[model samples]
Target: MTKKTQPKSGSEIFVPLNMLKKSPHNVRKTGHTAAEIEGLAASIAANGMLQNLVVEPERDGEGRETGHYFVTIGEGRRLAQLLRVKRRQIKKTDLIRCVLDTEHDAHEISLAENVIRLSMHPADEFDAFALLHNEKGMAADDIAARFGVTPAVVKQRLKLAAVSPALMALYREGGMSLEQVMAFTLTNDHARQQEVWQGLGWDKGADAIRRALTEGQVDADDRRARFVGPDAYLAAGGVITRDLFDDENGGYFADPGLLDRLVLSRLEQEAQAVRAEGWAWVMVTPEFDFRATSAMRRVYPSEPELSAKAQRRMEKQEAEYRELETVADNEPMTEAMKARVDRLEAEMEALRGQPVYGPADIAAGGAFVSLGYDGGVRVERGFIRKEDEAPAAQRREREPEPSEGREGSAALPERLVAQLTAQRTAALREAVASRPDIAFIAVVHAFVASTFYFGNRVSCLDVTVRTVYLSGHAAGIDESPQGRACSDRQAELAKLLPAEVEDLWDALLGFTQEQLMRLLAHCAALTFDAVVRPGSTSSPPLKHAEALSQAVSLDMAAHWQPTAANHLGRVTKAAIVEAVREGVSEEAAAQLADLKKPAMAEAAERLLADKGWLPQVLRLTQKASARMLAA
Candidate 1:
């Protein structure tokens, strides 16, 4: 119009770097974060700029060419280049490729570019990562550097891409989820993955998918696998399936048979060493149950006595620890003093539980060898099988007078022993009621006994301290830490208890004061019938149980945690969301609200894993129930 031919819309042009200004018409109001700028800079540095900046000519107020441009869509890229220029890596006059637009509204053009963009689907990312590694021969570290992610993340994505292609198709089609895809990457067995996929109908979750794929496999962390170290098992031709997504996963041994053989081989070797100690006989089993020896008798080895010097040291340490504890309660002590107290306590623990049985007991009794939770060999001594029992007259001399109305002294039937223990438990309760401190200690002892060991009755006490066997209602309860502890203690005690009720009196007299207190606690613990009934949860006994829980500072979190199998999966989707909201945060709950129940449960378990959360009933305070109900 003014003797100058106007440039056509959608024209291509080259703009100088220093001449490009951030467009005032940009739709994005929030400025890019420093991390975003740094990442963008890295991407450009590694591989030169890939996207074109949308820009228009900047006109002076006099309507004259200003030799400048306004960058519309790629302001982030413009900044990244400026950063390169500041580092003297590029000149300010470097030409940038840009699309010049004039016809469309500037703001509308920017908004359209920002709004129409779609993020690359995670499935595409997985495949892309795999292609770079497989076709281009790029390592995980190289790919991660280009993408600004951890090498572990790149490996995880590469593994994800290796999942059954059919399953990946399903993931792309929205028929499956990212989590399900990740779970399928646990193994590269395409046939098994497809088999599991077909068998699973709907509402499938990562945990269920993983379980199906790993069926018949033992976790590398399993006691059996641990007993036979992973390297040893692998050397025996065992295969392992590992999860790339789980950094902490120890992996699953695909051949459990091989692992079992190795465990047995190792245990037998340990048994050989134990047999050299001169036992009547040594038996090796994968697991030894004290319950299996209820028909047997256990003879004691004369208790070991501490040497004079050791006894003096022990007493001095105990006194010092008590004094430090006293001062700690009244006022804070110096760090050095507190540390000294800790050292003394540790020394006492090291000295306190030395093996009570002696060489003579080993000769008279056989030992059972098995694996402990940590995969260490456990040798349980002092069991007298019926065939190994002493001569009748000698055994009779070992046992003294029978309780009133009880006849047999040696090898009385189990039913009679039970009756005698019941009677003695009643007498012990009456005795404990008059001695409140002993009663409280007995109760505490009952719980501690779960962590420690010893439980049986030659009528000293058949401490069948059953506290509401929740195993039926809560599957895998027996496998829980607290549950296993209690079960193991009960079995060990059964092996040690005298088979004859007539020997009960002499056995009780030999029991240490601590041992007697344990028996008393066992008796008291058995009487606790405070299990919540269908409609009687608020009964008087439960109140007393609550009081006792508070007194003992019973923190259930240490004993149990919510797992997909134990708590979350059994509850409703709404309940899972609420638990996440309460145990974590509202935002976290919102993230899970859209997930299906099974997936939500697994997600909730991960979220609450280390949070140390518990339900109202598990809380020590009785008021917790009221507060939860009100909420």
Candidate 2:
């Protein structure tokens, strides 16, 4: 006798809609929402069921066929079809395709269909979306409608698909993360994207990748872009690349050159208007470094008297502001009231524009017109460049007459005066050295002058204060404890110091002896150095810095502790291991030997923290004794 063969698990069969029943063993506990069912129903009506339902044969207790099927999977599709039938869009007796299976348990079939199936990777989905839109000629809206997603999502997925094929391949191979791959889409240059990927090697993160991709591009939210406005940029034929996936402030302007040109042109127009005011010259630039203006003399703008009407308005505003303050003190202030107060203050300020320069001063001085950080035009007037100064005034400043009632007063050369001042300076130094308290005050004064009154001759003391810019990059230099301590000390001194330079001496005399010493120590501390200049083969100054640190018994460990951001991340694997060994233990260093650079760096940072290990540059040198000359 021949035996009958059973059907495969996925064998297709047609079943009437009325004959199907929802299975109680369905894994998905939640019922479909009306909107979801409607969407599914619409999709089915448009393209028919894309997937066959999984149904098992219903059997009676005697193991006889009941002529009904239980849906172990695809219950959502069943509900959708039922809704369609209820809406009369399809007949209740219509046949639906289904997979016939009864050998497996109902629960097993439901779980396998819902839980065991893996969703498509996002990269593959992106590529598939692109393929449908590009090769199949489907509009974004049509694709979105078919997939039950918004058009914006479809467009974003298409954008992701536009990334370099090489980068996408890396993403597929698990070599890069989704975010890191998304950063490459900022630019469409495949060669550049690959170059950046290789340059980053294994160290770069998503933010770094985005920064590299937008190197020459300006953020659309930048002050210059805001000032120029997007409409103007696009009208000028400048391109902008947007990131739809992430919130990057409307994306980046791809043509920074054009943006800069627009900024300069606008500034030039502003300068031309200022030049018409009878100034000697009007200079325009996007950025103006105050350091560059040190050599020039600043002529203060004379405050112009307000008109009678304006004075009345100002007085009224001031009275209102006072009233608001009193009310705020007694009761809570509303946002609208605060805004009104701010507007009043702004109007008062506008009425008091720049001081009016006299005709003569205007003729001798020029103006600098630039864009402020807020995107508004900033005009600095009445700055007299040295070359533009009158010849008579220049002569008077250059020439000095001999004073009477002094030895050799008839004619003393400039060199002799310099020599005399040099001697005086040396004597002052010796006096200050003997009195450490005064020496401390002097150092503190110099520090304050450099930190707060930078590029200005504002010190009452005869000491010369130099303002030094680091000019070389150092990791975590700003966040170091030493930096924070100095900043705090500066803030305290700034509060104590008199606003006017003439009152500085009196202010210094008021400080207690202990306060004076602490200020002096801080000031002297600023003089210490371990800076390495760029392109320098040897740092002779660093040797002296070590000596100075030793002289003061500098405890750098108290102010600094190594971290990944400041030290470990900046060095090689070998260097990190050595740092860890010196700062922690040999065993700790050994534990980090096999880690990747980033992980090793992090481990080293944590191990070295609070271990009191100083880099060679930060170590103090031994104190040297002075030798007496033999007679």
Candidate 3:
């Protein structure tokens, strides 16, 4: 008898491929996809099978060896090797590495292999990719090929590796999401990344984090940035910040101050060209200001009648077109005939286009050079300064040309002004909503001014202001929070009044002063219209609304938060980014600078919520409410 040693258990074996069989006791039931098998085959062909299949011996009822093994853990991998043999990449008899388990149950082995693994953490994978690039000196494309990923994915992973190490640890500990991690990649400055991360709330979202990090930079599509094209700005030594996570948002100009200088330089150069056209003076501005330009005088270029040759060509083309018309009514025109009509129309139009400007009349006028809507140089020629306006002697001779908008008024950004003012009105309405003191003051003021002043038309105090129908221009105005509160208050007050008009005076006499004042305040609040009608000014009511707003310490943030449906979505991208900078951080706004209008507005709404951000029209010169409340 030999000395009995415990037979080696769970031994590794090089099993012949044909002897491997699918195990009925294996845990996984879902069949492998064809593509999964193909990818596995490709991975195996390149890497030579990195893992072993777990197996156990196959036996009959008498516990006799059946000359085969049942695969437990890696049926998928076994299938891939079979595919390789079918493709002639390997032979069916090729030996495959496997673990032969005799003591452990087959299903338990399969479950352990399948369930005991965790996918590599994103930070780890990112670092591994970075190691390939930084240590191994591998390019993105080469690393991508080795890892079965696209070059862009490799590049992104590498960039994520460059994020602040502290942030990576947070990600590892499961404190931050992959989206939030991607946001940190907008800037390469680790200190900034750490600072922004530390300052934000734990739940701060990706867009908010991105905006805060990018606030100091100008967006690539900013008017000034675009005016100085990215290539030129870079050539001029401007820096740019790129985010690999969101290529759609584009890059940001890290040097906004530098871009502005470049923009003004370009605008001044454009002004010099305008000056050469013999204008008295040329004014350069980054953009037109309505208040600054509204009082100026504008002159027109003298339109000369067409020359004799042009008139003759137009007449001839008209005759030829009539001839073609008669033939076309009978039959379709040949290509040559159509070409003749086109050529005749072109020649005639070219002749008609020759309306020469008499430069002599425009010499007295100067140009206002500024940036246009899409960032091109805009030159408005023949705009005379107020002092340079035509003398009354000359003005009486020529007919005054009709101009767009009121004479001497600058063009307005009508939609933006109205939208902002409407939001302000909503906030103001809420502020005055509960104040009975303001209503009492207005009523007393109106009575004294109207009763004492003999010949006065009305007091500058518009105490009896008219109610505005807001739904026409303000979307969802009727359903606004402020609007609903006012409606509820009004309805409640209405129920207290006598049903018949004859009994109203008796009922009011019976009520407490507080109850009467509540009714008065509700009535006054209904007429509180602070909206600036689009394309027109509402000065008195608006001015009065601001004064009343201070009395209540109106904190609009309590009543309003920016949403795509409300404020940001209605404004320009520039406005949206500016709000982000004011409410969040400059870096955050910078991240949004490159986004199209819709995305920028939505991002702004997220960043500005509960941040005390208010539009220009809604902002007060001072937080009178806060100061008084402190008192």
Candidate 4:
């Protein structure tokens, strides 16, 4: 029978480095590279092996003790020591202190030592690094070198450590995730951090926290900021907050009031430059809406003559361009020909720079200079304010009074004049209804006169187009597709008409029947009123407008749809649900009914999109007969 050997208890002992062999049953499957081993060797050489290697005494089949030991733990340290011995830094007979055991399972001990050793938590590591920075007076680069990390990584860790103490406590207590903790580092306001943390529930995520923190602040990427530039804003003593953990495009400006002031100051400076050009007045703003200059009269700028030198240069470039074109048409195209052609075109463009306005016209007109959407300066010249226009009575005194008409309109009293105009309007309507061609011409003339002459006496027709201003605001009213289409068409037609009012009749005679019909439709569209007046129902006018829309087959869905920015965000939760229920399916509305107002609005916007739905104000009436009855 085999006899059992007595187990030996663990004890600290000094073993020769050459006698310690790495165990095959080591838990670690990968070993360090040559460079890493070198680094460790240098560390061990300087620190004298701070940790002890765990080893087991080698045994024979007869249960007898051997002089050699098998390393169960610190296999990496063994390799590093071997490297030092090969470099002749340590002798082969040098002794390494180790824990010796004779009975313990080497595999079990190795596994426990590797798998159970806990790494320091990232939060604790961040705090430690911050301490090294603040207490030791070490810079980021120095800390990074000591810790074997990049300077940027050290900076990021320090930023995380700079978060509010309350939030850091929450993180340490396992109440907040690492991402949530990182988001709180965007701002240095301790109260705000606590408020956001207390206000948010589990459903709100890091993005929500970031948005809440950045509320009322402008993004650095905004056009206004881009126009004024960060340099200028910083020069004006503006403070900007940064997000070190997340890539939010340079973060946001903390002081929006300062940003606004800087923008205004820049705009005012630009306005001052424009004011020196002899204008009657110069208006400046960061942005101007469509309604800003809607009621103002616009004057046209006259083209300026070119200088003698510029004219000669332009003529020479033109001649060169023609010669290149002739050569290209006759011979095979070459790079030299292309180059010459491009040069001539560039020269011509340089000669055709912005036109210079005359002093006389500049004195009589004004301009609007503002920051454009693309961060460039936009200048709109030759706008005459209403108060600056010449009085009409002053010029009329030089002309003779018109003779009395068949109704003797001039001699009539004010009330009688109104009565006579009422009768004449009825007669005119009947006459226009009888002749479609004349009606088309009359509407076109009236519209053209109003557009070009600013409602002056440019048309023979006496019909006046009615205007209704809504008391309540509607989203995208001025920027709707229909409005933009009409504006574009008007601009196109304006380019074709004569500058003088007296030549309008001759220009009208030149239009084809199709052109006249298009012009008439546009003019007719301008006369329709769908505004809801204050303290009064707009049912009659709206009903009439619906009829006109239906006759023209207006597609409101093509023009507009509900969006969070335009519609849903502006209304209450109940209104949003109702809109979804009417426009989309009731099931969709029910699904969104339980959400908060902002969340419900966002969901409704998504659900209603591409559904071909419109609000009541935008929808056209069914037919002309239905609309006429309502009217």
Query: Clashes in model 2: which pairs?
Result: none
Per-candidate TM-score against the hidden true structure: 0.55, 0.51, 0.48, 0.61
Q: Estimate candidate 2's RMSD in Å.
A: 11.0
* Candidate 2 local Cα displacement, residue 462, angstroms: 4.8
Residue 304 of model 2 has an lDDT of 70
Every candidate's lDDT? 0.74, 0.74, 0.72, 0.73
lDDT of 3 by residue, 1-631 (tens): 9986533557778889999999999888889888678768766876788988888888999999797889988899999999989989889999999987888887887888888998988888999989889999999987765555668888899889999998899999998899888988888899999877766543367866876777778877776777888887889998777776546346888888889889889999888877887777788977653334344544344334677876887788899899998999999999999998899888877766643324543565667787765668867665555576544125334456578544334455668667776898788666656776554444533432232221233433455433344665664454455655654564456546532233444565567768866765665565567777778775877888888878776777777788886888888778887889889998888888666675567667877878888887776656675676686
Summed backbone clashes in each candidate are 1, 0, 10, 0
Question: RMSD, each candidate, Å?
Answer: 11.0, 11.0, 20.1, 10.1
- Model 4, global lDDT: 0.73
Worst 10 contiguous positions by lDDT, candidate 2 = 622-631
Q: Candidate 3, which segments miss by more than 4 Å at Cα?
A: 1-46, 51-118, 135-141, 269-280, 290-296, 302-304, 312-349, 354-356, 386-631
- Stretches off by above 4 angstroms in model 4 are 1-121, 147-150, 164-178, 201-203, 245-249, 289-295, 302-359, 391-442, 466-495, 508-529, 532-570, 576-631
Ranking by lDDT: 2, 1, 4, 3
- Candidate 2 stretches with Cα past 4 Å from truth are 1-24, 29-42, 54-72, 78-106, 118-131, 156-232, 241-254, 266-282, 297-631
Compared to the true structure, candidate 1 yields what TM-score?
0.55
